[model samples]
Target: MPEYQRIHVSYNGRLGVPVGLFVAVDHLRRAGRLSPDDEALWLTVDDWFIANLPEPPQYSDGNTAGVVTWFKPPLPAAMQRRVEVATGLLSKYGVPWSISESDDPGEIVYEDDFQVAVVPPVRGEPSPMPAGVTLGPTTGGSKQSLGTDASAAARRHLAYYATELADRANRPASPDRQRQLAAFIAQCEALELATILEVGCGGGRDGVALQEAGFDYRGVDLTPEAIDICSEHGLAVTVASAADLPFEDDSFDALWTMSTLMHLDGDGFSRAVAEVGRVVRPGGLVAVGLWGSEPPRRRVDEHGRLFVRRSDSQVRQALSRIGSVETFETGQWYDDGEHYQYFTLRAT
Candidate 1:
């Protein structure tokens, strides 16, 4: 059976936010204009959540992880009361609001007795960052209350990277990743490719390699924090989703995206691959990687995560929509027991 879930839902049809963040938006909006009474009520509810629940990392990190959380259904009497109180305040303010009471909310990040966090698929391109709304490197101590400046789409896009934690710094590339990099370079060597675009370039770790190889390396990622990190290392990485690369069609010689597409499951995944095909020149090479299974597993599990492992044939089948899969390989990421899948495809 699908798991029952409860969340302070957004109206965008795919995204949901916790009630705490929702209320924080209204409370902060009012507090800026000197509404002390609303501030007091906000404190009343905020204190309860802070004391009773473990705050999700996305909230603490200014939601740079691009994830929002949901509470499982069948709330305890104490918790249900808080939900009621939160709704009452929204009603009092005449603010639009909703509750998601259903199974299969989105791709869940983690779930426990109290709540489940999810990265819901975004509807269209993420909204441009509002002026004066800057994201920076942050510690784990503060909760950034959402303000009216950000749109629901912007919030969902932010939630997309919620699972990519802070530790994805410019660390040394693993041996398996290094080997995969060499393989990609070798595949492009005979063709003498010049420019490469990395979709979802995390921490510029691999972009640094491609740059050092004398290729003009450019990248795009959804997380602004990640863009900041990657740029510090002199990589020209921007903030954009894979489904919506900012470049024109047939712009680059090749593309590289590793372990990134899986986060965008179902239609989101397919659309991104098509977009990937759109940017790279026809007949150019594209390298794709993911943590996957050997026998070709592809399905949303009971927990709502897009768990996957595609056999080489299945991988070829997936790429057939846009190109021909030339070579495919899988190796266990020895540090963890999980398997890593790689593919080199020729854009059509």
Candidate 2:
């Protein structure tokens, strides 16, 4: 590999001192965390260090002889724990650390010291930070609670949607839509899937189907009304945000999220995706359905229900790095007199 160099680091407000990359890496090395054979990967500094290292560094898994590699940016956050989250390996290196068994040799990307890396905002798009919304360098401790705000907002949105469903039920899934859903389920059955977790499950319609079809599953929604409705019918359900699923890691075999993720605008969406990957087992499958729209359209419907809609392209881009995506299509669903677009995605 080309000489391994430059890693990214972001400084959060609380850390008090400025440190460089090599110094931080050396500390981990001396502490016997990173292997001694690895040299300080050159780092490019912005507000953070964007380090370019190997795919699965040699020091990674303590194989010291692992391939020398580089990354202009640190590995994405979801895989950070396994790789490492050096706040600034070049800096003072006061960030927290965690350890666990590794499932794959290539899974060695981490956010060391830097708990998370901000994905570049969509091309040429500068999203003015929302008033009162503060996003900064993350610490391992802080990341556990990363999407609390958006998840809270998401819950409220889900509640509104549930009420809308009860007060004015959308026409049942069309034969075509139901067929599509069933076909997806059939594919899962072929895989002998044992469990499914649905986030933003509204009124438990799909969950009910999954359960009736004999699939082991549980669901959560941001809105209590939806959870209550599902519970009354004796379905397993919880009122919680997508970013903060209460389940243990790798708790399920597959996950299904529909028309839910689009509600998160920027980094919140990314964090929620990370949470999904964290909670699902390696090689587990994930399926998502979203409405296709450009940017995110915020509006209130005639019944005073609010929605955050994004174009198909935007949804695909947001999820691109996480896994391979298949089956994206736009179709129409009739809800009363209105037409809604349905865009679906599946990844394993």
The candidate scoring highest on TM-score is 1
lDDT (CA) per prediction: 0.65, 0.51
The lDDT of model 1 is 0.65
Candidate 1 residue lDDT tens string, 1-348? 346555442333212333334443343343352133333333434455666777776666566656666777677655655565566456545545665555776788777678877776644333343355444332333233432232333343344343443466645778888888998887777799999999978778888889988899999875555665676788887656687677899999999999888666566677788899899999999999987655545664433334555555555677888898887777774443457778888999
Error of 2 at 252 (Å): 1.4
Deviating ranges (above 4 Å) for candidate 1? 1-166, 294-312, 333-338
lDDT of 2 by residue, 1-348 (tens): 221222423331122212223333433443433221111111111112322222233333543332222242344432232133243233323443222112232323443332322222221322343356443333312121322332333334433464575643234766756876787788789877789998987777888888888878799865445655676556787645676677898888788887777665466678788788777776667777765544446665554334557666666776665656666656673342222344333444
lDDT for predicted candidate 2 compared with the true structure: 0.51
Model 2, position 307, has a per-residue lDDT of 57
